[model samples]
Target: MTTAYCFDLDGTLTRQELLPLIASSVGLEDEISVLTEATISGVLPFDKSFKLRVRLLRDAKLDWIHAALSEQVEFDRHILDFIASRPEQCFVVTGNLDIWVKPVLDRLGIQSFTSTARLDDGRLDGIAHILHKGDAVSSLRDRFERIIAVGDGMNDVPMFEAADWRIAFGGTHSPNRLLVKLSDFVINDGNALCRLLNML
Candidate 1:
């Protein structure tokens, strides 16, 4: 039977979040930072807020951002190795754009479900679609006998609820108490992430 493991990208996979870096890449730090704050605070809806940020930085060169993102994104390497040991079942399910997370995802060689953006004249035109992450997991459940999800943000709660096992990574976001209350497992350290995965 196939088992599926879905992971969030931002704080779950990196020491720093992607949007702020994408903003800084093109000197739109002020605007994106506000959107990031609003997103985390629930001031703005996640998808609309994220789209606004992307549009603001639409002129950024995807290549430059990807190269720069390679240098900026960092996270627990050991958890990665743990996933590598069981490659067939692991995947990334994020609200982030695929292009921005491509470098890190490529490095891990994992399949992903993420938002998509359109490009025009070597710049982002806008996000073409938002990946309904929880819906993605719901659909994947038909193919997998068991599904596990790990994440640390408001957007993840829905996916977490759909999982056979749900994990909140406090090492990243300030997880919602409701999510933690429902989680089968909660881990705060990166090394612990491997243990949680192994147990599943």
Candidate 2:
């Protein structure tokens, strides 16, 4: 049977959140943190908050944003190794903009579903599309027989709902309470999470 593993990029695969790192490039980490917290806490919708954060960080140079993300964003080694072994079956599903997360995606060497960016003159103009994580899961149905999703945030609810199996991962921190409730499995260690994936 063909199984697809879908991992949320921030805090699941990566040790730190990408947007805050991108915000740091333009000295807007504090501002971004507010929106991020609100979004994760379910106070702000992911799409609206993501757009606001993107607009706030839009003025930062592309090179600086890339450098900040590349330097500060660290991946969970155990999870990274698992994906590297089966890159074809692993996918990073994130609400992050395409341009901002290219470095991370390139490193994983796997297919990704991310929000698209609108660029003008080699600069970030705005968001062209905001990805609905559930839609991403549905889109994979034609290809994979079974879909397993791993994530740690409120934003992952739709994805969890659409997936065949859900794992609430807290390798970096505790998975959101609601997300944990929806998951078939709750794993807090990267090694344990990968082991569960192998078992499934």
Instruction: Give per-residue CA lDDT, model 2, range 140-179, as digits (tens).
Output: 9999999999999999999999999999998887888899
- Candidates' C-alpha lDDT: 0.80, 0.92
lDDT computed for candidate 2: 0.92
Candidate 2's TM-score:
0.98
Provide TM-scores for the models. Answer: 0.91, 0.98
Q: Which number leads on lDDT? A: 2
The TM-score of predicted model 1 comes to 0.91
Highest TM-score, which number? 2
